[model samples]
Target chain A: MAFLTADDIALLNEPQLAHVATIEADGTPHVTPVWVDTDGEHVIFNTAKGRVKHRNLERNPVVAISVSDRANDYRTLWIKGTVEMTTEGADEHIDRMAKKYLDKDTYPFRKPGEERVIVKVTPTQRLSQG
Target chain B: MAFLTADDIALLNEPQLAHVATIEADGTPHVTPVWVDTDGEHVIFNTAKGRVKHRNLERNPVVAISVSDRANDYRTLWIKGTVEMTTEGADEHIDRMAKKYLDKDTYPFRKPGEERVIVKVTPTQRLSQG
Candidate 1:
C-alpha cells in the first residue's frame, strides 16, 4: 500500500473540498464533492448512511479522490484507495469537519434521524502534482 | 440526456479546475484535476495522447467530471457522460484553454512529438448544488 506524504497530510488538514469518485453498479463513475479529513494515514470523509456514495462504497470499497488546493489549483492530490466505513464517532467527526470547514460547532446540515458514516480510505496509490 | 444550464456554462467559463474520473480496465476509478471548458453544450477538456486518462477513455467512453467554484465550494457541478475524442483542432483547443486558464497565447508545457487530444463530454446526467 502507498502512504501519504507530510505534504499530503498538510493538504488534507486544510479546508479544501475533495471530489470523490466511486463506481456505480454498471461500472459508470459517480463523483461528488465532500469535506475531507485525514488521520495522517487514512484519508477520511463522512456521509449519511444510504446516500449514493455510501451505497456505492458499501458494494465497492474502491474509491478515487481528487483534491486541489483552494488557493493553488496546481497543488493537487489524487488517491486511489479502499475504504473501511463505520458509524462509530461519525457524528463527532462531522462536527470536527464543520469546525474546520465552516467554523461551526456542529454540522448544520445534519438531518434528524439521519445516521452518519465515516469512511476511512487506505491508499493503494497516491499521486501528487504541483 | 441532460443539458448544461446557463449557470453550468458560466461555471465552465471560469478558470476553475475540474476533477475528471474515468474507469480503469480493472473497473477501478481514476481521477485527476484538469483545466475545463464548455461550448454551452458539452463539457470539454484537453489531454495528451498515451496518458492513462486518454487510454482509459479510448477503451471506456464513460466518464465523470466534478467542477466547483473556486471561490465557493458549495457551488458545484457533477456530470456523468460519455466522451468523444479527436485530435482534430486539439492543438488549437489547448492554446485556447491556455489563454483562458493561464492568460498565455499558447500552452507553454507542450512537449516535442507529443500529440494532444480533445475530449468532449455529452452529459447523460448533470447534478448541481449550491
Candidate 2:
C-alpha cells in the first residue's frame, strides 16, 4: 500500500517546517525541527555533524518526520525512512538548503568546507491526516 | 538520562506548534501537526474522534512529538510517549485548549458535547539537540 495518499503529499508540499526523529542504538529517539524540500521522489534536510541526530543516523538510519500547517485545522504529514547522508558537493548542498529556507535575494553562498551534511530520505512509508 | 534537556523543556514551553506521530495497529505511523501545552509533567494534544491518529492511539498509543524554534539555530525537542484520551470533563477540555492556542479573553465556552476529546502524553523519552 502507498504510505502516503494524494492528500498527504499535498500536506507535505505546503511551505512549512517539519520535525524529524532519528533513533539511537539503544532505541532512544531524537527529534528536531527542520525545514524540508521535496521533489516527487525524495525529501531532503540537513544537520550539524556533532549533533545527536547525526550520530544516530550514523549508527542507524531509520527515522520519522512529521510536518503540518497551523491555520489549516489539523493537517499533518508523517514520513518514515532511511537517511542517506551526502557530502557530495558543498556548494550544491548549501544551494538546495538555502533555496528551501531563504529567498533568492537573501540566500547565502557557502565556502567548500562550510557546507552542511545533506540527508535524502526515500520515504518507505508516509501517513497523513487532518 | 532525561530524554530532554533543560533547554529542550524550554523549547517545548515555547508558543510554537509541533508535529505528532501516533502508531497504527499494523505498525504504520500516522503523524499530524498540533498546538501543544506543557504543565512540566506531560505534553497534551487533541484529535477528532474519527481521524487516523485517534484510531492509531486506540490500537497502539506509542507516539513521537517534535517541536522547535525557527529563528533559533536548530533548537529542537523530540518527545516519545504513550497517549491517554480523555472525555472526562468537556468544559475543562475546551477551556484548556482555548487557553493554549487562543487568548483567554476571547476564548469560547463550549457546551458539554461540543468539547474536544483530549490526549495526554506521559513522555518516556525526550531528546533535544541544537
* Fraction of the true interface contacts (Cα pairs closer than 8 Å across chains) found in each model: 0.63, 0.31
lDDT of 1 by residue, A1-130 (tens): 3399889999999999999999988889989999999998999999998888888899999999999898997777898999999999999999999999999998999888999999999999865421
Q: Among these predicted structures, which one has the highest TM-score?
A: 1
Please write out the lDDT profile of model 2 over residues B1-130, one tens digit for every residue: 4444677667666766777766555443445577677656778776656667677777776677777664553566677787888867634655666676675733364444443667888888655452
TM-score for the A chain of candidate 1: 0.95
Flag regions of model 2 displaced more than 4 Å: A1-15, A24-29, A48-51, A55-62, A69-78, A81-83, A99-116, A124-126, B1-15, B23-30, B48-51, B54-62, B69-76, B81-83, B90-95, B98-116
Candidate 1 lDDT: 0.90
If you score just chain A, what TM-score does every candidate get? 0.95, 0.75
RMSD value for candidate 2: 5.5
The backbone clash count of each candidate, in order, is 0, 2
